[model samples]
Target: MKKERQATEGLVGLIPRAGALAARAGLDWFLLALIGMILLAWLFPELGVDREPLSLGDVANYGVSLIFFFYGLRLSPGKLKAGLSSWRLHLVVQLSTFVLFPLLILPLRSFFEGGEQELLWLGTFYLAALPSTVSSSVVMVSIAGGNIPAAIFNASISSLIGIFVTPLWMGLFLTSSSGAFDLGSVMGKLVLQVLLPVVLGIVLHRYWGVFAERNKKKLRIFDQVIILLIVFTSFCESFARDMFSGYSLLDLTALGAAMVGLFFLVYGITSAISRLLGFNREDRITAIFCGSKKSLVHGTVMSKVLFPDANIVGIILLPIMLYHALQLLASSVIAQATARKAGWEATGE
Candidate 1:
């Protein structure tokens, strides 16, 4: 027991520095965990407990509920108010998340027609429909010297809107492709799991808000731990259901290729738009980081709400898992490059 405790303590000790490194590197630990979960699903199919489908689903639902509850707890009304001051930047970020992504995804549907490919394409569309990441987007904006308040507001709002918009968009697109989706059921889950907790937090903001603000650091830790649990449970379900039975090396390669293409395409478009809009170096940095990201946290939560079945959930999350890794590696390199260029330009080197 002493040995086990020390080992656990050592791992906990590393989390702070590891989290700092992850932040500096422009990567999110949640994204890393999502990737790790996917690999675990592939490696150990029989590891997690075999529970009834509804029981597993209930666990997933509760996990998502707790996640958003903390999301609300951590949010400061003052910060949100301050962030809203930069309405123009917020509009741009929100529009890019909702409008630009859906338009881009529309044309790609035809590329995936049958078999697992169609499911993968649906996953891609789901990825595109989701919101920009919260922690990573804000971190990247900070690294690139963008408007921090605006980043916070836009990221938070994106997740909120995604609870509704993502499903609505999917229902419209996937109905013909995958039959009529249960819009009522999806909306009910979103309301209960996502929106209610947020509203509850906001209502109790007057009392708990100060406490939440004081313990922001601890709340963040709680959030990350909850996310890790969610990832583990989701992967366990996927493995138990044998959802990855037919997955192969070639399929992984193809998924990786698709993820790469999607990342570059979005990044290029956002970069060009920033340039065309005459945004300064800072705003451009913000645009590139914010516009290109899709949230793994939101994606995971929504997968449960939007795609309840184990196989569909597994497939829908695949591209998102791949994209999460690609974005981290790609964005880290790009941010570093941009930072170097900015330093040189400032120094007149």
Candidate 2:
């Protein structure tokens, strides 16, 4: 009994230490949550997908609206205006995010012209068209001693622009290929589900803005949980339909490599452009971080509205998920390294 008690205590003590190590290594808890949710979906699809009283997918849909509402509540128009003076920086970042990304992926259209690989290209295009991530971009910029205001402005504006632009980009080809994609319906849903909540939140900002600000961390967690639930239902549906059956090990490996390559390619281009524009280090950091990221939250939420036909969604989601994981890992390392270098320079190393 004494030996067993000591053994149990030892095992319990290791867990928190292990978790601390993971945190120090910059492993995001939300990513772990995502992987766990995917596993749970694989094992038990019915819980989130078709459970009796309340389908969790419906809950996630509502959560998406609330998440955006809080996002709007946190964004101050005054701050946006203040940051707008940096027009050159803003232009470069926005163009890199919306234009350059798709153009880089355009060559792959020929490479993946047939069969299962075609979906990979489509997914890559969708990933390209996504807005820069808000929270992560801001966080990394802050860490790297970047211009926080510009990062905030660009990230927030990117998301707002993406609400209109992303769908338009995807609609171009989706109309031809699927023929089921209705641009009008997508815009309507965007207006109702996404845009309305954001407008309402902004209007009520005077009342709840402080509260939202104080609870921002909690709200971020709430946003991530909603995303995880969406991933759960999406994968559950995919598993049920065997939507991932066409993908092999080699295909997944190639997708991951493509995602990483895309990140670096954009990162290099933005860095070059920022240098050419004579941006300071802070502005360059903001531009690179904001311009290079693709938002998983927006992608997942938009997927629900854009792809009503559930059959192809798993394939559609695969590249973005891979890209999401890769960017988080890569960007965290870059941010930390950049911060370290800044510190060294400050000490005149």
Candidate 3:
């Protein structure tokens, strides 16, 4: 019995190392696959596949449905209850998400006046209209010692609200470009694609919540894989449709600059607001995460509904994709430094 117990203890010690190795291997494989897909999409646009025009709307709908179904599965009543109690933190986060971003974008439009300016404006608008991200926001909040449940609630609710609010914002701004802002069509799509699946998942949550909670780790992996697929497919379509044809290195540089500016600006504003409100360490962390993030999932899904034109959709997704990558890298570094500082403070070292 002693010998068997020793062997089990040894196995348990290996689990973390094994898990890390598997993660690194999986990421390598995913990157290789992404590169391969991009190449295929670019090199062989019509390799046995028909060159018929593709509809961004259909793809967007499919992606949105899959994305939200998984989102619903992850949310729980307990999380919601905890988040609701922190109303002040929630208000600051939501305001930063919906209000401050849009205000910033209006003045920046003049910089890209001519030459693919529409694309630039569309990209900026997409960033503004998007909601706070779910995963990364929560991760950062956890790192900053923030209210985790509030971050989760704010992030999740942002996505749901963006389903309607994003379209309304776009319609107001892109009226000439998008044409006849059809609220009915937008709402119908939201109902059929997003709300329906989420409702079903919520209904099943009672029976499956325990299983979901138990398998949360596994489900997160599955969610990431699906997002990777969505990104791959969307990029492939953009490549196949020759969306990058006229875009130059200079244009990309501008887009990058815009993304960097937007992120820092939001971060500064949120931090200031938190300070003004006299929030504790945790609430400040929540504010930073919730304020800084702009959801690629929401943007991708909304672009399809709001901008049916594939070219427009491609352009709208550009800054969002850049922002997503930038935020992940930036926030990871910040979160680690903050965590280390927290540890030091706790230890009085």
Taking all chains together, each candidate's TM-score versus the true structure is 0.84, 0.93, 0.83
Put down candidate 3 lDDT per residue, 197-235, tens digits, no spaces: 777777777887778778877776665555554455556
lDDT of 1 by residue, 139-213 (tens): 777766777777787888888988889989989886776786888898997998889998888777787878887
Model 2, 117-192: lDDT tens per residue? 8978898899999999998899999999999989889999999899999999899878877788889989999989
The numbered model that scores best in TM-score is 2
Superposed on all Cα atoms, model 3 deviates from the true structure by an RMSD in Å of 7.5
If both were scored by TM-score, which would come out higher, candidate 1 or candidate 2?
2
Candidate 2 local distance difference test against the native: 0.88
Measured with C-alpha atoms, the lDDT of residue 300 in candidate 3 is: 60
Worst 10 residues of 2 by lDDT: 20-29
- CA lDDT for candidate 1: 0.78
**Candidate 3 off by > 4 Å:** 1-37, 47-63, 176-178
lDDT of each: 0.78, 0.88, 0.74
For lDDT, candidate 2 versus 3, the one ahead is 2
Give the Å error, residue 232, model 3.
Answer: 3.8
